[model samples]
Every structure is written in structure tokens, then in C-alpha cells.
Target: MAKAIGRGRGPTIIDVARVAGVSKMTVSRVINNEAGVRDGTRKAVLAAIRTLNYEPNIAARTLVTAGEARVGVVYSNPSAAFMSDFLIGVFEEAAAKGVRLTLVKGEDGLAPPEAELRRMAQGVDGVVLAPPLGELPAIRQVLSDAHLPTAVVAVGQPTGEGISVRIDDWQASHDMARHLLSLGHRRIGFIAGNPDQSSSALRLEGCRAAVDATPGAELIIAQGAFSYTSGLRAAEWLLDEACPPTAIFASNDDMAAAAVSVAHRRHLDVPRDLTVVGFDDTTVATTLWPPLTTIRQPVRQMAATALELLMGAIRNGAPAAGDHLLSHALVERQSTAPPNRARAPAPALS
Candidate 1:
């Protein structure tokens, strides 16, 4: 029996062939969108692919017949969940296009050195930048000086920053704050993301806008590194304050989960004694005792789209100055709720 591809795993051509009840050659033709196959057979193959969520390794398929097309990716994110999603998107897209992807980890999310970047750009046609690497001027200068086409994901604004793709961090964070506000959370504590990433400022701006617009709501921010330890320290600081806020919002899931842990240590009931929310709906969001309410950034889809755009730029041999804005959603779970009156004070009148 052929083992089916599990969720988050790539489906093979043979697997598609079995589901479509067609030969492997027919499945290949369908994937290549080539003519000569009967309409009925083509439809069956496509339907099977859709049902299985199949993503073909296009690079492998085309390597024998066409010249190699390679794209390099530089990333430096501390969260394993975030990195996993981001790479999956890029690789899936690369496979679909039959383009080879080479990944290089940046030191602290910044490209290594000019010589290293020059070497990396030698055979690579283009590059994909992941924040905060994408936000670094030095990295951009290195790639730009090397004449390498590039795309960036999760950047704050378009800025014509080398074929950028991102969701509106400011809007998403604003909506998150609005959800908490609607739930009667007035004095909200925010843990800022790494200052090196542009998304951090944008998220802070969005949260601040929502808080400022609401009557009698107060916003207190703590510096964070977008890491679990940072979240723990920040949460501890907030909880230790004489007048700690009724609700806490961490910039990312790692920090948010850490904040939950801190609350547990303090003997606070989640969403009861203290409400907590996180940014990315990564794996950690649901692993907590009470699942986290968070903003879903669509990291995987964004990564995929960035690769697609980067491939185009590589083909054209010139960087494209364009912005591909993807969508974001606020995922509600058990982690957030109205303020606990006994544990915290009510909203102050302006």
C-alpha cells in the first residue's frame, strides 16, 4: 500500500497517480499543464492533486530537461515554528516552479559579509529575505551591490524594497487590540518585538492607535526580543508592577506562551486572573493549557509568494519594486477575555 502524504507533507507524483487512477506519465502531463492528455484524465489528475493538497517538486521534474534555476534565502528567526512555516512556503513554491532553493542562515538575521554575499550570489539567480534580515540596510546594500535580484517578506511598508510581500502588521495588531478592547480590557500591557525588525514598530503603532482611540484605555509597553525568555522577563515585569495591566499582549507566540507560563507561576488563572494574546498563530498558540488568541500572519503563504516574485525578478534580470500584500486574521481562542474586576481595576475615565 502506498503511504499517503500526511498533513504538512508534500505529495508525490505516484500518490497523485494512484488517486487519479491514471498512469504516472499522465499525472506528470497534468502537473506540467501540457496538452495531449484526454480532458477527462486531466481533470481527474487535477482533482486528485487538489484533494490531496499535493505540491510537486518542480525543480526535480525540470532538472533533466531545462537549465537549473536557483534561488537563495537568508533567514534568522529565533522561533522554530515561525522558521518551519516560512521555509515550507518557500520550498513548496520552489517545487511548484521547478526552481532550486538554497538557504543560508544569517547571523542574528543579518547577512554575513560582502564577500560571503558576493560568493552566494555567484550562481544564485535571486534571493529571498526574511525579517529582520530583510530589514537590515547592510544586508540590502550587500545584495544590491552584488546585483542580485531579491524579494522580502514581512517588511512593514512597500518602500519599493525589492519585491516585498507582507500582511499589514499595523492593521492586524490594531484589530487584535480592538478585540481585547471589545472584551473590556482597558489597561493593556504590550511586549514589543525585536527592534531590528520593521514589523515590530508597525505592530506597536497599530496597538497604540487602537489604545489611543479608545476612551480611558492605557497602554504600557515592555521591550522584548521576540524570544521566550524575553517574553518571560517582560511578563514578570508587568505582573510585578504595582498597577499591572489587566491584559497582556506579546508580539509573537513564543513570547505570548512565555507570558502564560509566567502567569501560571504567579498562580493566576488564564483569561480569568489575566488575559493574554499573541501575534503569530504558530504551533505554540494551541499547545498552551488554554489556547492562545492571536493574529495569524499567514507566514507560509507569504513565503511562497515571495519566492514566486523573486523567481520573476531573476528571470527579468532586474529587481522588481512591488508590494504583494497578503491577508491576516485574528484567531480567537481561550486565552483572552474580559478583565477580572477583583484582580484588576476598571477602565479609568479620561
Candidate 2:
């Protein structure tokens, strides 16, 4: 008698073959999307697979005899709501690939990183990192030391500075600036993100390039710590400047929301009186009174592709290297416009 594979333990190819009255080779072909199997046989095999809740082992050899394979995702956040989308993106892809996402959240609080990494590394076949937080050299080194296939989904730049999956942040910001400039705005305010992150530095560089490209346009730059409070302070400084910018661009949605708040308190109408824009199309973009026009980060698609890349690496029977850059789109919401009704340029003091 064949030993039963317990529920939630994952069904093997042999289990599918036995239940469907077919050979293991046929099951393999069907799972890989190969076209040789008979349609009727394929349906039977699929039905049996569904009956047993069968999920093919995406890690290949690691599935059969060894312990359960884990895919570690190192994220940085103080709370879950901060990364609700990230967690959803990661786990949904993991489930489709029949791999588990072993999450490790690190920042100021939570568990000791080294100890946590060690614990999370247990039975892990690959690693996925979500950053500005995860793009650290030390973090990649830890994954390298484990010799696991790894992918980094960056929050900032798409330099692939390290092994990562990112969109071109510099180009994205540059495009954002150009959009505002096309609307006939001359003086533009730019708020940067965390200083330590490569992404933040890259975005600032993009803004500078845009300013350099637009003749007669002045760049009003302020550094923010990538938080709502930091965003408010930075926007306040820019707004306080004499002959303040007509348009404001924030590096992320959180800061952008803060900027809108400042504009509101000053009784400035968005788009008509002052144009505001933000990066990363988070829920906050739509939730704001005037929905933000921002860059759409392909987070969920990146997450899915990361899983596919990791699985491919695992099947190759070696550790993974390098990075992947996904495409990004501009989601134009209601937050941005030309400073058309510009009134006496609004006293910078206000």
C-alpha cells in the first residue's frame, strides 16, 4: 500500500498518477503545460489533482523526499498595514507556485535580524526581498551565504544596483516632472525619500535631470525621511520659500498626501491654485479628496514574476544571481494640473 501524503502536505506526481490511472510521465507533461497528453486523460489527471488538492512542486527536486521548501521574503515595515499590498502580492504568487512565503519583517522594532534570518532560512529554497528596506548589501550577502536563489523587488531605483527586481525609478520621476512641465509649470517643488536608500538618491537625481532639461524651470528640492511627518515638514520648507514652486512632486504617496494636507490648510485649491503629484500608486492616491496622479508600481506583477524566476532557478539546480526590471505606468488621477489661475503667485510666507 502506498503511504498516504497527508492533507496540506502537498500531493506528489505519483499520487496523481495512481488516482488518475495514468503514468507519472503523463502527469509531468500536463503540469509543465506540454501538449502531448490526450485531452481526456489530461482532464482525468487534472480532476484527480483537484480532488487531492495537488500542487506541483515548483522547487523541483526539493519537493519529494526533503523537508518542505520555503521562500523567504525579507520586508521592512513597522506594521502590517504599511505593507498590506506587499504581503498580498507575495503570498498570492507563492500559493500559485506551490511554495510558501516565510516572511521576515525588520526595521527599528521586531526580532533580532540575524536570529530571525537564521530561523526563517530554515527549509527555504529561495528568497525574495522587498525594498528600500531589502536592498541592503548585508541583506543580499545573508541570502548569498545561504546559497538560496534570491530576488529583490526594490522600492526606489531600478539600477539593479544589487540583485533586484525594480522599475526605473529615475525615468519614472523624470517622466513625472516632464508631465508637470508640459502643463506649463515653471517652478517645481520636489520632495525626496529616505537618504540611506539607493532609490531615494536615484529619484532625486532624476528630478535634477528634469530640471536641467527644462529651460527657465527652477527646482525646489527638500529631503524627506519617506514618512508622512517628514513629507509635511519638507513641503512646508518648499512652500515657505520666496516665489514658491507652482507644482509639487513627492517621491511616494505618503509624503504626497502630507503635501496635499499642507496645501489644503493654506486654502489653496489643488490643480487650479497648486498642482501636486506623487509616486507609487498606493491606495492613498485614490483615497485623498483629490485622487493623486502618480506612477503605478507593478508590485503584484513583479511579485508573480519573481516567483517564476525563483522557480526557474530552483529547477536549474543552482543558486540564482542578477536582477529583473519590470515596466511601470503613469496613473493620472485628479491631483495634478497646470497652475492656470495663478493668483499673485500666493505669498511664499503663507
Query: Between which residue pairs do clashes occur in model 1?
Result: 58-95, 58-98, 59-98
Flag clash pairs in model 2: 131-155, 157-199
lDDT of 2 by residue, 30-113 (tens): 677655456777788788788877778764333433323467777774323336667778888777767766778777423337
lDDT of each: 0.80, 0.72
Evaluate model 1: give its lDDT.
0.80
For model 1, the stretches where C-alpha displacement exceeds 4 angstroms are: 1-67, 316-319, 345-350
Measured with C-alpha atoms, the lDDT of residue 292 in candidate 2 is 92
Residue 286 in candidate 1, Cα distance off native in Å: 1.6
lDDT of 1 by residue, 1-350 (tens): 33457676677665675566544444555666655667777787788888877787875356324645778888888887888899999988988988887778865455667677767765465789887778778778866654566788888865575789999999999999999999998899999999867789999999999999999999999999888989988988887777988999999999999989888877788989899999989989988879999999999999999988776544433335698888999999999878988876332222
- What value does the lDDT take at residue 326 in candidate 2? 82
Error of 1 at 76 (Å): 0.6
lDDT of 2 at 171: 91
Question: What is the model-wide C-alpha lDDT for candidate 2?
Answer: 0.72
